[model samples]
Target chain A: MTAPAAPQTAPSPAAAPAGAPAVIRAIHLSKVYELGAQQVRALDDVSLEIGKGEYVAIMGPSGSGKSTLMNVLGCLDVPSSGEYWLRGQEVSKLSEDELAEIRNREIGFVFQTFHLLARQTALRNVELPLVYGAVRADERRARALELLRQVGLEKRADHKPNELSGGERQRVAIARALVNRPALLLADEPTGNLDSRTGKEILELLDRLHGEGHTILLVTHDPEVGRRAARTVRVRDGRIESDAPNR
Target chain B: MIALLEGVRIALQAIWGQKLRSALTLLCVIIAILSIIAVVSVLDGMDLYVREEVAGAGANVFTLRRVDELKVLTDLQVFLDSLGNPRITLADWKALRAEMTLAEFVDPLRSRSGDLQAVRDGRSIRNVDLQGRGAEYPGIEDLDLERGRHLTQADIDQRREVLVIGAQVAETLFPGVDPLGQKVRLSGRHYEVVGVFARRSNVLGQDRNIFAILPLSALFAQFGSFRSISVQVKAKSLGDFAAALDEARTIMRVRHGLRPQDPDDFNLTTAEQFLTLWEKISSGIFATLIGVVSITLVVGGIIIMNVMLVSVTERTREVGLRKALGARRGMILFQFLVESVTLTSVGGVVGIVLGFAAAFLIGAFSPLPYSVKPWSIVSALVIVFAVGVFFGLYPASRAARLQPVEALRRE
Candidate 1:
C-alpha cells in the first residue's frame, strides 16, 4: 500500500477573528485534597485552553478530575499548583472577594442538582446573582424577569422551586445562571437529573446560545452529550486522557 | 437598602419555615423582657402612689426635732436638755408669728387621746382620740369640714364644749342622725358637734379620719398635760416657705433658750425628704430585680447562640450553595445575624404587649401598684436587640468561615 499522503489543511471560514482572547487558560494546574492520613490528587498537571465562543465538554468517569477542573474554571476553588487565567485575569491568585466578583461578572454556573433556593420563587432565584452584584431592586427584578422569559419560564416565574417540575426547575436554574449576563456559562451535568427528552431540549437551548457567540463549558459523563460540543476533553484518574475536535 | 430588606425577608421566611422552633426560641426572649417590664412597672406605680401621699401630707411643711446618734445614751439627752429644748409651744408660736417676716400664720398643736363617747338617739360610739388646736389649725393643716363650723378663738377662750367629729366617728355615733349641732358626751362632759370633718385618707398606714378635733383649752382640761407640740406655719409664697421656716426656728430657739451652735432638738420631715426616702427604697428594689432579670437575659442569649449554631450545622448545604453562587462571607454572616435579631425583636414586641396587659390587669383588679414606663419599654427592646447581636456573632462567624467544597460534601 502506498504511504498515506500528509493530510491536507483547509482554510476555515469559522476561525476566530484576529486578536480574540481565549476565554479560559489553565497552565500546569493541580488540586490535592488532604483527608486525614491520605491525600487525594483530584486534578494533576492539567493544562487546557478554551477559545472565545467555543462549546467544549469535559467527559470523565467517577473519580476523574473533571469536577475539580470545573470548580477551578468557575473560580469556586483555587488550584493547589499553577495558574488559571480566566478572561485575562489570574483567577487562581485573586482574593476571595475578587474571586466572587469574577464569578458574578464572568462565569455563570449551572449545577446538576439545580440548586435553586427552595423558599424563593423562580423569579427570585433568577434575581439572586443580581443581589450579590448589588444591582438596584427594580433593575434586578426587570433583568431577572427578562432572563426567565429567555428560558421560556416567564409564566412559571412566581412558582417556587418545590412547586416546579424537574425540567422547569432546571430551566429556572439556567435563567439564574444567565441573569448576570456572564461571559462564560459553566454547566456540570446540566442534564443529569432530567429525562432524555428534556436533556435534549436543554442541549438544544445551549447550542442556540453557543451559536449566538456565548462560550460554553459543559462537564458530562455521556458520550452523546460530549459529541454535541465543538471540542471534547476526556479525563481519567485525575489526568486528561485525550483532547480533540468533536467532529 | 435592598440587601437589608432582602436579608429581613429571608430571615422572616426562615423563621416562618420553622414556626415551632422559632416560637420556642422566642419564648426565652419574651420571658426576659416580660420580667423587666413587670418589675419596672410595679416600681413606677409605687413611686407614683408614694409621691401623691407625700404631696397630700404637706408640700411646704418642715418639722424640726432633736437627732441623737446613740441609743439610750444619757449624755445626749443631758446635752439636748442643756440646749433648752426646741419643743414648740404656744409662746413660741406667738413669737414666730411676730418675728417671722415671711410667716403668713402659725399655730401650736398638742394631741391628747381619751375614752371619748358620743351618743345620739340611744346609739353610742367610743375609742376616739382627740386633737386640740388653736384657731390657725384649719388654715395650717389640710382639713376639710363638711358641715357647721370649725373652732374659733372665742371657743378656746370660753372653753366651750364644741367638737368637730371625724367622718368615721360621725358615721359610727350618729349614723343617719346628722351629727352637726348634735350633742355628744365625751369624758363625762357633753360637747356640741359644731361641724363634721370629712374623712382624711391614710398616708403610710396612718388613718387621719378616725380622730376628733377639740379646742386647745378643752383638750388641756381633759388630759391635764401635753407631751409634744407641733407648730404649723404657713408662708405667703412657696419661695418664702423655707425662709419662713428658718425665721420660725430662730424665734423658737431664742424663746426656748437654745445656744446659737446647738442643733434643733426636734424632727424635721419635709415632703421632699419623704419623696427621697421613697425613691431610695424603690430604686434599691429595682436594682436587685434588674440584676436577676439580667441573668435571665444572658441565659436567653446563650440559648439563641446554641440554636443558631445548630442552625448553621443543619443548613450547611444551603450555605455551600450560597457561597458557590458568589455570596461573600459578610453576606452570609449578615443574613444569619439579621435572622437572630428578627427573632429577638419579635419576641420583645410580644413580651411588651403581654407585660402591659398583665400590668393593666394588676393595676385595675389588684392592690399591687403597676404602671408601665415608656422608657422601660424602649430599654427592653434595645436590650433584646443587643443580646441577639451579641449571641449571633459566633454562629455567624462559623457559617462565614465554612469552605464551600467542604460544606457541600457534608451531606
Candidate 2:
C-alpha cells in the first residue's frame, strides 16, 4: 500500500462523507477490555472516515471512549472486531511491526503532556522518528530543521524539553509530529496542558497546517477545542453520539 | 550500523543521566578486569623471566648432584630418603672425566653459600656466593667475561690463587680501581682477581651479580676437601646431549658401585628439567589467579545485569516512545546491548591500562620482567564484551518485550 501524501490543496470541502478516498476508514470497529471478571466495551461499532487535508476533532467527556477511538484510528491499538484501513492497507490485521511502520510513515502523534525525551535536545527529538525510519543523518537533520522552523522553534533547537516553556514544548512536539510529513497529524489533547492563550496559538498552528493541505485529527474533551475543526465527532458510552460538519 | 551508532549516543546520554548509579556499576567492572589483566601480565612476565634467567644451564649441558631437587620438592619422603645418600665425591668426578666418551667437557662444581664474605682492604661484601670451578666451567655455562681472561687449565692444575668476581663485587671492592690482578680475601685466604663476570639480571629476588668464582685447586687448598660435588657436563652437540647424559649417569652409577637392581642415588638436572619445573610452578599460580578473577568478573557481571534491569524499568516509557516512533524490537535490543558493551569495554580499557602499569612497576622493582602481548589485550576486550552480552541479554530482552501500549500507559 502506498503512503498517502499530504494533498497540495485543501481537502474536498469538510465532512469527507462515506466511500471517499480516505486517509483512515473504519468499518464497524469495536474494542473490548476485560477488567478481571468484567468486560468493558471501550468502542462499540464506531465507524469514521477521515479524508486527505481534512481537519477533524474527536470529543467526549471522561470515560466516553473518545481516547479509545483515537487510539484505534492512530494504529496504536487494534480493534476487537471489524476492519480499520489506513492509506488503503487493512491495518486491523497488520502485525505489530507492520503497524509500527504505518504509524511511522502514515500517522504522526502529538500528545497532551508533550512527551519529548527529556535528555535529547529539541532538534534530536524532532529527528527521532526519521532516525527509526532509517533516514540518512543529513536528510533527517534538514527535514527536522525545516519542521522546527515551521513551528517557529528553530531558535530553541539546541534546548532540551525542560528548558522550553509549555507553549514552546508543545511547538517542539508539533515539529516532531510533522517532521515525517505524515498523512494524518493525530493530536491527543495537544493543548490540554497549556493556558488559553497558548492553547489558542497551538490551535491556530493546527489551522494553518490544515490550510497547507495536511490532514489533522484532534482528540480533546473541550467543546471549544472541538469547535475549531471543520468537522466534529462526539463519542459517548463507546458509540458515536454525533459526527457532523461544524457551522 | 547507523542505528547502532545512534544507540550508543542514546546510551551515553542515559548513563550520564544517572551518574552515581552508572559509576558504581562501572567500578565493579573495573575491579574485575583489573585483577584479571594484572595477574595475567605478572604471570606472563614471570614465565618469560624464568625461561631466560633461571635456566642457566646451556641446552647441551646437564649437572649431576647428590640429591634431586625435583624429587625432593614433589615428595617430602624423597627429601628424607635422599639425605641418607652418599655424597658425590671428587673421585667419582675424576672417574667420569676419564670414562665419559659422549661428553665434551666435564667440570666439577663446589659451592658454599653461608657467611661467605669477600674483603678488599676495609671494603667487604657479605652474603657473597663462593663457587669452586674447573677450567671447563666457562665452556659448560654461558658465562660472559666483562674484563680480563677466565681461569686457564694451567691455573686450575697449578692451584693458582686466582678468582673471577661478579660485576657487583668488582664495583663494590674496587670502585675507582681496576679489579683485574687485585687481591680479594675469601674463606680466610687472598686470591688475585683474574676476571669480572658481566652484570646479570636478578632471579626471584636473588642477585645474580654478587658471586665470586675460584679455581677448584685453590678452593680446596683454602676450604679442605670437596663434599657433595656437582659435576657439570656438556655434550659435543645437540644430538649428543641425551647420549652424554646417559653415559654420565652410567659412569656415576659404576663409580658408586650401584648394581642394576639398586636405584641410583644421584640426580641429573638439565636445562629442560629446570624449565619444566618452572612451568609447573607458574601454571599453578596462573590457574589459581584465573579462578579468583573469574569469580570477580561474574560478580561484576551480575551487578551490571542488575543495573541494566533498573535502567530498563526506568526507561520503560522512553522505550514505548521509541516503539511508537517505529523502532523495531531488534533495534531496541541492539540499543540496550550497545549500552552494556560500551560500559564494559570502558571498564576493560581502564583495567588494562592499570594492570599494565602495575606489571611494569613490579618488573622495575623486582626480579620479574614485564611482557605486553597484543593478544592478551585483545582477549581481555573480548572477555568483557562476552560478559556484557551474557549479562545484558535478560534486561535488554525485557525492554524489547514490553508492549508499547502498556508501556506508554505507565505513569
iRMSD for every model: 1.5, 1.2
Residue B374 in candidate 1, Cα distance off native in Å: 5.1
Among these predictions, the greatest TM-score belongs to 2
**lDDT of every model, 2 decimals:** 0.79, 0.85
For model 1, how does the per-residue alpha-carbon lDDT over A154-216 read when each residue is reduced to its tens digit? 999899999998888888988888889898999999999999999998999899888888889
Task: Give one digit per residue, the lDDT tens place, for model 1 in B1-411.
Answer: 666676677777878988888999999989888777877787788777777764555666664433322212324665556345444555655666677788666666776665555555655655577888878778767789988889999998887889988888888778787888888887788889999888876543455677788887787777664455666667767898788777766766666676988766554446675566556667888889899989988988998999889888988888887777777888888889988988889989998888888777777766666777789889889989998899998998899888876776677
Residue-wise C-alpha lDDT for candidate 2, range B379-409, written one tens digit per residue: 9999999999999999999998888777887
TM-score of each: 0.81, 0.86
Instruction: Report the TM-score measured on chain A for model 1.
Output: 0.91
Clashes of each: 9, 0
Per-residue lDDT for A1-247 in model 2, tens only?
1222223132432234455568887777999999999999999987776777788888999899998898889888899998887877789988888888888888888999888999899999999999888889999999999999999999999999999999999999999988888999999999999999999999999999988999999999999999999888888999888777787
